[model samples]
Structure formats: structure tokens, C-alpha cells
Target: MPTELPMFPLGTVLFPGEALPLQVFEPRYLTMVDHCLAQPDRLRFGVVLIARGHEVGGGDDRTGVGTIARITSCRPGGGARLLIGSVGEQRIRVDEWLPDDPYPRAVVTEWPDEPSDVSDAAAGELTDRLAEFADLFARFSVRQGRPALPVPVWADLPGTDGDRGFALARSLPIGAIDRLRVLSAPGPGDRVLVLCDALADVVAALRFRLADPGGAE
Candidate 1:
């Protein structure tokens, strides 16, 4: 049987193992939170990146695949709003969309991650590339004079396996749709290639930024 869950579509995609802190104020979402809380497990809901439109309104399109968000902490936010701390759990593929009179609901099937056939050497190289990407991004941000945002250390990620593909995707700066594409990838090897392609462009751009500050921005 497909698991039915409350869907909260936003402009951002949640990669498994990512922690998201969100504010819930919309009436429908408040009700959705209530539903999640009533469940036996800690309030768990589905989180999808909106395909189109904004997060503040109805009529937004959403991606079919998303991660389950397990609420870790919930507290009052000023008035009727709520401050929620959640971590991405499992990936799910939306099989059906239910009515959203109050809040979004969906029937989804589990889309568990599949490992890759990457050799030990390839895996180590991939991990090194991720770390290098982080260092480059941090340096680029500093050069741009933006507040320093440290890149997530790839080793700290759970599991020392192929799924680090998604881990790397979440760590780097990539487009929303691209991130979704990574999630939909067949296996870790594919996802790693996708991320590597994106990283190439980003690294080149950062180098350009270094050479001609006015040329790249």
C-alpha cells in the first residue's frame, strides 16, 4: 500500500540527511502540522520543491519525488505560527495527489536509494572532489565579500557508501531543478556524474571571478 502523507511544497528541495528549519504560519499548514503531530511517530510530513509558482499560495506545481521530513523540534512562533526543526528521512515518489482543501496530501511510494558500482579508487576521488568543491565555494564566497558560509564537510556525512552522491549534491550550490534531477537519478554513480558536471561549471565560474571580478558576477 502506498503511504499517504501531508505534502509541504516549497521553492527548495530537501536532500536526505539535510536539516531544514521552517516557519509554519499558513492556516492550511498549521492544520497539516496538527495532522502530523497526531501520528505515532514524531511529526513526519512530505517535503517537495514546488515545480512552479510561489510557496505562499495555492495553484503551485510540485515535483513528483520528495523526502520525508521528520520533525525534530516544534515550538510556537510569535502567534499562530510554528517554528519547526526537521531532518530529511526517506525519499518517496508521488503516486497520487489528493485534494488540498485544507492542506496538500499525496499517496506516495518509497523510492529507496540504490548504491553504485564505483570502485574504491573512484569513490575516494569522488569524495575528494566534493571536499575540493566545498573549499572552492567557500573561497569564492569570501572573494565575493559575502558572509562566509562554510561548505559541509563531506566526511561528516552518514554512511561511507555510494549514496554520497546525494550528499555531495546537497553540499554544493546547484539549481533547484538540477537538485531534483540528482534525486531522480537511477543510482549513485549517475548522481555523482551529474554533480561533477555541475561542479565543473561552478569551479570555472569561480576561477573567472578570481581573474576578472567584474566579468563573472
Candidate 2:
């Protein structure tokens, strides 16, 4: 069934079952926050990827395929300082959207969740590589006086590993199109594979950065 949802077009993409922390300072998004909190379902907002143009006046052109997200936690950072944690649910296709309001509203078509097609061997290898990568990341963060990156529970939950991979794949400081490509992948194997490639890229980038803080020719 189609639903009319309030839209939060972000500069990034979100993956299902993954948590995203956001600071809501924009007036329109603050309105979105109020609406979501007041709604009965609590499933009031959809997180859309910013595709083109700026967030201020971009309209619907800024958003891509989105996932229904719920406001899991909300805290007041001060006067109008809103901190929100959202967990991605399912994908949705935007049918119609209207901009120029306090917040954008989109008539969306829900995309149901599809089961994973990843083989055990593939999942295992992916998990192993991801674990090594995550451990390295956490160690680096702690060594740099930053909070430690959480150890991803990659074994007990197969689906979660895929979700984590996809989430990190989108979040890395890579090309925008590559992030979109991961989001648009066809199926579970394809998505996981894409994530693996992204992880590899991140590892390579980290090595390069550590080797040379400046882009030395």
C-alpha cells in the first residue's frame, strides 16, 4: 500500500536495520520532527539520499529511493537543538513529492524486504574481512583519542553483517556515485559484493592516508 510520508533528504544514504544519528537544526526538519513525534504510527518519516542540488531549495530532485525510518531516540541539544536516531526499515519508491513547505512530503510506494541469497562461504569470507577491517578501524579510533568503533556482531547475525557492510559502504568518504551504486545494487549477493569492494577501497584509502598525511606528488 502507498503512504504519504514526511521526507528527510540527507546528504547520505541509509541501510535497512542500521542506525543513523542525525542532528536536526533546519526549521523544516524540525517541523518534520514534530510531525513524526505526533503521528500515531511513529513511522512518519522516510530518509532519502540527496541526489542533486542543494538541500535548501532543491525540491524532490534531491531525494532518491528511500527507506522508511522511525525516530528511535530524540534528545534536545538546547533551544531547538534536536538529536535523532533513526533505524532504516524498508525501501520505498517516491511517487509524488511536493517541496517549498517547512518539510517535503512524498507520496511513497513501499518496497518490501527481500531475503538474502548469500551463500555461507561468501558470507563467511565477507565477515572475516569485515571483522579485520572493523578491528583496525576501532584500534585507530582509540589510538587517535576518538571513541572506539563498536565491534560489529558479524557471526550470530548473517543479515546484520550484510546490512553493516552496506551501511559502511555508503558512509565512507568515497565518490557519491559509488555510494549510490551500493544503495541501488540488485540483490543480496550483489549488494554484499559491492560492499566488499567498498570495504577494500576504504582499507586502501586508509593505508594511503597513513602513508602520507598530505597528498604528496
Candidate with the greatest TM-score versus the true structure: 1
Write candidate 1's Cα lDDT for 83-149 as tens digits: 9999998889999999996899999887876766656665566666666776776776677777656
Where does the lowest 10-residue lDDT sum fall in candidate 1?
A: 153-162
lDDT of 2 by residue, 122-145 (tens): 677678767767766765665566
At residue 37, give the lDDT of candidate 2: 91
State how far residue 98 of model 1 sits from its true place (Å). Answer: 0.8
TM-score of each: 0.85, 0.72
- Residue pairs clashing in model 1 are none
Residue 1, model 2: lDDT of 80
Alpha carbon lDDT of residue 47, candidate 2? 78
Candidate 1 error regions (>4 Å)? 119-135, 138-142, 145-158, 215-217
